[model samples]
Target: MRMMDRRTKIWILVLVVFCALCAGAFLILRGIGGDGTVAVISVDGEELDRIDLSRVKESYDIEIDTGYGRNVVHVEPGAISVTEADCPDKICVAMGRLQGSGIPIICMPHHLIIAIEGDGIDG
Candidate 1:
């Protein structure tokens, strides 16, 4: 066993504090996501459709058929997700639903993308 010197202890404390601060900043930024009500669907860098999830009263399914493949996007109130995908991996379908502006659902084989964006934050 070895005892840490005073300088090593101070440096360790500094590192711990810095890490704590970084974690705090990350949490704050993550919590302050965009207004997350409008979902934008795109295929191969081309905009296809935009749906306001906030105004959705009943859930609906949107089928996106590209030349590459197909994906079924399920839309619910305040959220959207890919319920089915023809891609081999089917990762998009496994992503469930997007709650905020964290990540976009993507189907690489189909070149389909569904991203949530902020319309405006209401006070």
Candidate 2:
């Protein structure tokens, strides 16, 4: 019984240390940034439009007619998203908005990608 209790305590201490290391690693790796608040829209691997979301004083809708299909993008003060799409899956529309610099809004069928470009290190 004494040996079993000691083994359990050792395992618990190891687990705690491992968890702490993982948490610290996550915080460090999550500090990556993009260049600014500009949204770069691309279709079929070609640059289509670049909209600066920060300078967008009024909300507007941009209708994109790609060779594959059509996608309606909505631009707000600080965000951009595909509000409507003709793709069968409609996954791009369901993505809602682009708020972070991690993943870009992708339309697989239309081969369209909307990525947020960071202006500087602070963005």
Candidate 3:
């Protein structure tokens, strides 16, 4: 079997270490999302509403309706959740409180989706 030269061995070790470090950084950063300027609300891949969470409370439990009926959502500090939904089963509401920012509370029956958006998004 052929053996690698000293320089080649050193280079390979460096590359492996670099790759491991990169992977570690990625995992760490993925957990620490940026406090960007906007948080969007969407449903079924369609943009429904936009909210500005800047200066917003650590947690919130609010309701939104389009003149038809009422729905409830619970927004915990840094995250939002649906407590009780007007829809049957209230599955979304029962899903428990969301503990993250950048996500949304969605109700498919009403074609409604709520996401966390920044002040930059248009009405």
Per-residue lDDT for 19-86 in model 1, tens only?
99999987775556575778889898788999988899999998889889988988998899999888
Candidate 2: segments with Cα more than 4 A from true spot = 1-31, 119-123
User: Model 3, which residues run further than 4 Å from truth?
Assistant: 1-54, 101-104, 116-123
- Estimate the TM-score of every prediction: 0.70, 0.70, 0.45
Q: Candidate 3, clashing residue pairs?
A: 38-118, 39-116, 39-117, 39-118, 40-116, 41-115, 58-77, 59-76, 59-77, 60-75
Instruction: For candidate 3, give the lDDT.
Output: 0.58
Write model 3 residue lDDT over 42-113, tens digit each, in one string: 544565444454445676656766344457765544565667767765766756644433434566676556
lDDT of candidates 1 onward, in order: 0.82, 0.84, 0.58
- For candidate 3, give the lDDT of residue 19: 100
Better of 2 and 3 by TM-score: 2
Which structure among the candidates has the greatest lDDT? Answer: 2
Q: Ten consecutive residues with minimal summed lDDT in candidate 2?
A: 27-36
Please give the lDDT score at residue 110 for candidate 3.
62
